[model samples]
Structure formats: structure tokens, C-alpha cells
Target: MSGAPIWIGAAHCVSALGEGPRFHLQRMRDGGTALRTVPGLTAKPMFAGLIPDELLPAGPRRIQRLLDRCLLELLDDLKPRPHERWLLVVATTKGDIAAMEQGDAAASALPLLGEHARQRCGFGAQPLVVSLACASGTAAFILACSAIEQDRYDHAIVIGADALSRFVLEGFASLYALDAVPCRPFDAHRAGTTLGEACAAVAISRDRDRIPEVIGRWVAGSIAHDANHISGPSRTGEGLLRAVQNALRIADLRASDIAAVNAHGTGTAYNDAMESIAFERCGLSDAPLSGYKGWFGHTLGAAGLLETIVAVQALREGTVLRTLGLSEPGVPGRVNAISADAAVPGRMLLKTSSGFGGCNAAVIIEAES
Candidate 1:
């Protein structure tokens, strides 16, 4: 496996925008947003993104359904492939959060969700659940890639899903982290983040010749923590900065190699400012920087994987996705934040995520060679 090449064999997503990668990608190309004033879920009408009732069934099993749709698709793409030695990594901030609100703590336990995925998907593999707040998806992805590269598994599947729930919504509200309108990442007038629900899946395999769906190579990944605060990111962006540097080092690439920076821009004041500082420190101040929160809102645990898929597509197209809803560059640093879609014309992408408990992660994806 040391000489083997790892590839993202397949990937897909389900969210407020729609199902499959086409809808999401088309919506992004058109600069359309799925965010709206979602009502009836909270006391007041809150600005957030919710899977339309027609698109996603309403019930306690929505999470399971998401796993079903996302997992089954990737698994289908992996036909004729053995899975007895494959790895399944589920990433979520809160699994079956609705169960907790309904006074079923045991059902809400993360491992139970993992077991459900294994049983529901009928895979021969047990599940490993990664729950590192908003960074869970990326962390899980990093692990899966590393495992396959180390010959620990024949292949790896990374699934990230987090449904919207009152418990989670109110928790963010308590911290005054919900924005009054759709989020505007890196914008001066940005207030806070708007939450969204989504499930995203990616498959990684060493068999490149047989897998044309392989979008790109997972060049490198790293995780770091600043120990700054539980919810707030480091004011100095220390953790995120370090993670990016480590990833670049591992890939043996310089900052100039990154075509675009697919950032975890949650639209929060502190997060955006911190990322601005981090990119500047990496000498990426002139890079085309973009965020996806405005297009899909903050999809929590699903964010990293979902955004990574988009970044891969962006890298192949040699263009940077727009930072939707961003009118003015603000963040207290001189960063080249994209206000509109622009040509980057490069083969590499730098995707970074930051989450609660001072956790941060980075992954560098390169166009399939």
C-alpha cells in the first residue's frame, strides 16, 4: 500500500438544495441559495436551510433515510467490489438528535447510530463514528484515507449526516450564534451563521484503474486544536493555521500550489476573522478564497465532506466557487475572498474546517492525475 495511489472513488450529497451532486453543483453554478425563513420549527421564524418536506420524509428515521440514500448510492457505484475488509466511517455532531429531545438518550447515543448504519446498510463492516463538532466530517475523511493508505482496509466510505433538531437549534440560539438572515461569509455586515441539514458520502479506494469515478487524490490531511475555547475559535487562528501548514508539508507542496481555499466560513465574526488571519499567515492572502455556508448554510457535521466534493469539482473546472451573499470583504485581514465565481486555473484545492472545542482540520485535494 505504500506505493498504492488513493482515490476518491465516488461522492454524493443530500441537503436543502436537493439530492445527488448535480442539483447542488448546478445550484452553486447559478449562484442560487437554499436558505429561507424556516418556520414552525422554532418559536420565531428562523433563517435556515431545511430539506423540503417533499424531498425528505418527516420522522425520527430521517437520519437513517439519509444514510440509506447516500450510502446506497456510493455502494452501488462500488459494485463487484468486496467490502468485508472495507471501512465505514460515520461523521456527525449529534446522531439521532431528535431522539434525545424525545427523552430517548440511549437511541441518541452516537454508537447506536453507527450500529444502525451498519445494520441498515447491511454492510459486513462495523462502523466508526467521528463526532468532532463541525469538523467531524473532515476528521472522518482524513482517517478513512489514512487507513486505506496504510493497507488497513481495501477501501473506505465516509458518511457525514446531521439532521436539524430543536435541541441543536436552541443550543446555538443560546449562544446567539444564529443569524437573522441567510449567512454572508467574510462579509463585514455578517452577523452569525444559519444552520442547515445535510448528508454527504465519499468512497476512497486504492484501485485506480477500475475506478473512473475517482474525482481526485487525497493528497494530505491534518487535525489540530488551539485549546482556546469550547465554542469560539482561536483569535489568532493558531490551530487552523497549523493544520493547513501540516497538510501542505505532508503533500510536499507550497502555499502557492493551492488553486483555491475551500474554507469553513460559518459566517460568524470570529471564525471568519480567524480564517482570514490564518490564510494571510500561510501566504495565501492572494488566493481565491470561497465559502459554501451561504449556498447550503452551515451543515454542521456534513459540511466538510459536502464542501470537499464541491471543491474537487471546482478544482477540475479550474474555477473558484463564489462566496455567496458576500458583498464586502471584511474579516480584519487583506484576503482575496471571492465575491463572484472566478477562474483559478490550477489543479489543487485547500479545504479547511474548524469546529467546537477548539478543533481544526485541513485536507488538500489535487485533480486526478
Candidate 2:
């Protein structure tokens, strides 16, 4: 089968920093951080980009309304061809689960999401929901590319969103993985991850060499599982390294060609160490690497896509923000986090993510030609 070029036409995101691309890019450039404390959770402080309660709509209908607003922004940015087949792919580990916890009536069924997609975006194609834990966002992007390659769709809308829910909060609390304060990824004093809520949408198409020639090429990507544990990562970083190797090999590139890495550094002990090892195995230990979760909190399902958006921006802008809470190097031999005024040009952006159920994924994006 012939491969197709997936062009990221436009991207829109809402996070702790702000809403939309302009807001987020400004925050990144200014080195501004939005990590703060939330009250009434537990004695320990929890730092997250908790969307203001007021900003979050009251019920399921309201949540869908919020999603529609973001979708409209994406559509406004890129008005795709009317005759082209458009596929809608929504990624979230807990879709409307926050509403369900509040006893909202319409948050239970998955199909309700498709209805929202259809109503809001006018995407007549069937909606697909991917709930593959943290990798959901990146996985959704890969799936959309596959669909286009197979001639199933000319354009695809990939959106990832999740709201902080009691279920999620309590579950992470049980694992004692919820940091009371902003997470310190790869920091010697790192504690745990802080959960954040966010929504991000990207428009991808098969048309290549177009106006916005895909700045980043999704040459190859893979999703693999450790099948070893549900919560913790594989001790050897086997799964992660395998995915990286596969991506690099498929792209006909070597680890030496990678300029930097956007890691899935959740600020947890095990994850940081494993990721470090994976990078080392892939011969990327010396590469400049960073993580955004400390700034945006772990947006769960949205983390991958939102982070990828930032990676694309890094490619276009030639700079990456430092890991917000990272300092003192928790993982040995792992390069220090980029904190300020570092410029990397002519390099490929390698992004990696791991989630519950041992799900892991990695993708490589190059600068726009």
C-alpha cells in the first residue's frame, strides 16, 4: 500500500496556560507557568491546571458545548474541502466521566460523543472514540493517518479531551501517585504527577506540498504494550525502546539524527527512570529532552496530542520550554531539562508516551520543508 502524507492543517488547545494556539505559544515563550494548588482534595497539596469550575459547563450538555466551542475554533482555522470525506476521532480515557460523577444524566454512553461531533462539526462520517489511556491522543493521530492512507478519508479531525473527575482523582490518590503540588518531572525531589484537564484538536489531511506543508512528517509510529503490569511501566523500558526503534527504523533514521526528545516524564520515580533508560537504549541519552506535564499537568488522554502540538511549535519556532518542575536531575545520565534560551534547529522531534494497561506509543515529527 502507498503511504500518504498527513498534513496538520491547524491545531487548537485549551490548557492551564490558556486557550487557543496564540495564548499557549505566548506562555511558552514567556516561560510562564500555571501550576497551582487546588483546595479540599486532601491534606497533601495537588497542583493542576484545573479549568476553573465556572469555565467547565455544569452538565453533560454543557461539556459537549465546551467541546463544540473548541471544534468551532479548529474549523475556523482550517476550512477543509466540502466534498472530501471527513473523519472525526475523539480520544479520551474518561469521556464525560466528570459529569457522571456529578450525577448528570447524559454522560454515560460513548455514542453521545459522536452525536456531539456530528452536531458541532457537521462531520457526517462516523465518529470513532479511542480510549487507550494516556496514549489515546497520539494513537488517535496515528489512526487518522492510517485511515487517510487507506483512502478511507481525505481529512480527519483528531480531538483529545478529559475533565478532572472524582473517579480519576481518587484512583490516582489510591496509587499515591498524585502530587500534592506541581509535579517535578525528572527532578531529584520529584514526588508524583498532577492531573490536569484540557482539550486539543488537530486537523490532518493527505494533501502534501500544500500551503502549510506538514512541518512535521509522521514517517512512522507504533503503539505497544508491556503486558506486564497495569499501573507501572516495564522495568527494562523494553516496550518503550521497541517503539522508538521501530519508529526510527521505519523513518530510515538513526538515533544520532534525533535532535531532541519530548518525554512522557510524569514526575514519578519509575516512569522517569524507565524513560531515561529507553532513551539511552535508543542512543538518545545526550539529546536535549523536555516534558510539558509539569506546566500543563498530565492531561491524561490529551497529553500526547497537546504535547505533540507543542513539539510542532518547537520545530517551527526552534525553541522548547524547560520542564517546569524539573531540576537536579533525578535520572542519572539523562540530560538536564531545557529551562531557558535554548535553540535547536534542523532536528526531528521524537515524542513518546506511556499510559495505564502498559500502553505506550512513540511518534517522530520533522520540521516543515
Candidate 3:
């Protein structure tokens, strides 16, 4: 944890919940569901949080359009110094995979996506493509911070984008993980997750003095894998517990110092329950908690960065966002799941994510004074 303090300079998101973190946060606060029962890119009548076609930039490749729009907006007015070395990190599960399915073989390769981003962003270094299942976005943050701390780069642009594809939709559908309606995380009647598409970006830099309005600083980040199952999480929540503990240790903050917990409540029976167990084990059971999948669906690789940006907004506004679609508690642990938006007293917040392949990540964000 003895690293340079990485500050969040700017962030933006384009998703089914609309563009930008502020707009999406307000939609969450308004309380409904961005999920719609529409014909999916794969099948008919599947509930999904699909970005509107008009919002997508005109292009032959949909995934590239998604990435370009978010990057353009995120880097707007973010002028890096002439001597500063920059790193471009792209986190995604499937990048232009749908195009690959449509006979574009190059689209299947992550490097192609990375090359496209590097050229567009005018960064000299080759982009690091992180395809670590659902934990890609959170893992990207860990990589960016580590690189900056080690003096590998002066600034890092982390972008996570995943456009819906038949390959991904069919895979999740085959697992019976798609909900019939908008997802309800931690609710007694929760069914499953709703797949969503989004592109989210955040700029992290050590030059906090240059970017004065530092929304939050990356205090600590830790990632661990249980190797328990390919898709299923550990029933004991051991991996996530370890991640939270490592993050807290690195940040030198106790569980009691956390003002809020943003759990990866994907509305699945096991995922939500496992998260509850992890939080309880970390002594964060009573912390104000929320799951935002109902608001924008699970944006696959973009979920972590997208949600983190929203959490940054919450820290700036001094509020805890409500978990959309949650009604009654179903988990065995006594988590204080936020049902309504409320003002929070402290500035420290914890964000956690658990993904396929038993991957788990936790990061602490503290509002800048």
C-alpha cells in the first residue's frame, strides 16, 4: 500500500441508463428500472439494458463506437503534460465479438480493440487489454494504480466497454442467468441478472494539484481468485473476504471506517448471498449497502468502472444511492441494504466485485477534502 496517491481526475459513461455518471445516478435515485423487455441481439423478448442506437456513434463496428464515444467525452479538456507518459488500459469481456460472429475475424482479438483506442487517444504506449471476465474493470484500476505507483506512467486512462453480442447473451442464457424482468438484487423474489451494454472511462493521475477537483483517491485495491468454479462463486465467500481484508490493510482503514459498501449484487441467488457473507465476514454487514444492477443491468466488463464512477459521484454529493429493485431482504447476513437514498456522514467508501472464474476485487475510495 506504499504507493503514490492516485487521484480520479475525470470520468464518463455511456450506457442504457444514458451517458455520464450523474445522469445514471439520478436515474437510480428516481427508482425504476432501465431494463426493458425487448428483442435481444441474440434472442426475442429478453430483458436487457440496451444502449439506444442513436446514442451509438455511426460506425461499422458497434463496440468501437461505444469505446470512442466514452473516451472522447472522458478525455475532453483532460490535457496531459508534454513530458508525462500515459498508459491506455481497456477492460472488456467481449470486444467487437459480435462483429467477429459476423465474419470479421480481426474483431475477436483484443489487440485490435486496444490498437484502435491507442490511436484515438494519441497515447504512445500500446494499450493493455484486460479481459478478466467480470472483474476486468476493477482489475484495470488495480493495474493503472500499480503502474503509476511504480513510475511506469504519469497518467492512466482506464476504459471498460462491452456491447451486447449474441455470443455473450447466448452464453449467459444457456446458464439460465438471465432474469425475465428487471433484476431485483437481494430481494426475496430475485430471479437473475439482466445483461446490459455500456462504456465507462476514468482518468487516474498522480498530479492532483493540476486536476484540482479530485473527486476521490484510490486508497487501496486488492484482487484474489478462489479457483473454486468456472462460473459459480464459493459458498463461503472466502476469496472476497480476503480481498476486502487486503484492501483495508493496504489503505490502513478498519471496516468500521467504511461509510458505505457497494456490493456486486447481480441479483443471482448465489451472487447476492455470497456478497452478504463476504461483507459480514469483513465486519461490514451493518454498513449502508446497495446493488445497482437494476438501474443499468450488469454491464459485464464495464460494471466495475461504471459503478465506481457513480460511487464517486455519491461521495462528492455526500449521499448513498438506493439499491434499485430491492424490496425485501433474502440473504442470511444482516446487511443494511439501502432501500432509499440518504445522506451519509463519512467520506470513506468501499466498492467490491466478484466475478466468474472466482475472481474478486475490492477498492477503497475517499472523497477529497
- List model 3 lDDT by residue over 1-369, tens digit each: 346688986788988989877788777777578788767466567888899988877887889999988887766657655577889999998888887798978658888998999888888778999988888999898889888888888788999999888788788889988788888999888988898999999888888875535779888889988778888999889899999999999888999999998888899988998888888989997789998888889998999999888987886788989888888888876789987887888888888888999999998988665
lDDT of 2 by residue, 1-369 (tens): 456566775777887777866577677767656877766654455676776555544453534755765787777766655687888899888777756766875766666776777667776777988888988888888888778777888778889888766677778888989776788888888888888888888887776533143556666677888778888998778888888898898789998888778888898888888888878878897778888887779998888888888777766777766787766787854554665546786558888999888888998877564
Off by over 4 Å in 1: 57-60, 80-84, 210-212
Model 3 off-target regions past 4 Å? 1-3
**What is the per-residue lDDT of model 1 for residues 290-317, given as tens digits with 9 covering 90 to 100?**
9999987899989999999887876777
* Backbone clashes under 3 angstroms, per model: 0, 4, 0
Q: What lDDT score is found at residue 282 in candidate 2? A: 81
Is 2 or 3 the stronger prediction by TM-score? 3
State TM-scores per candidate: 0.96, 0.92, 0.96
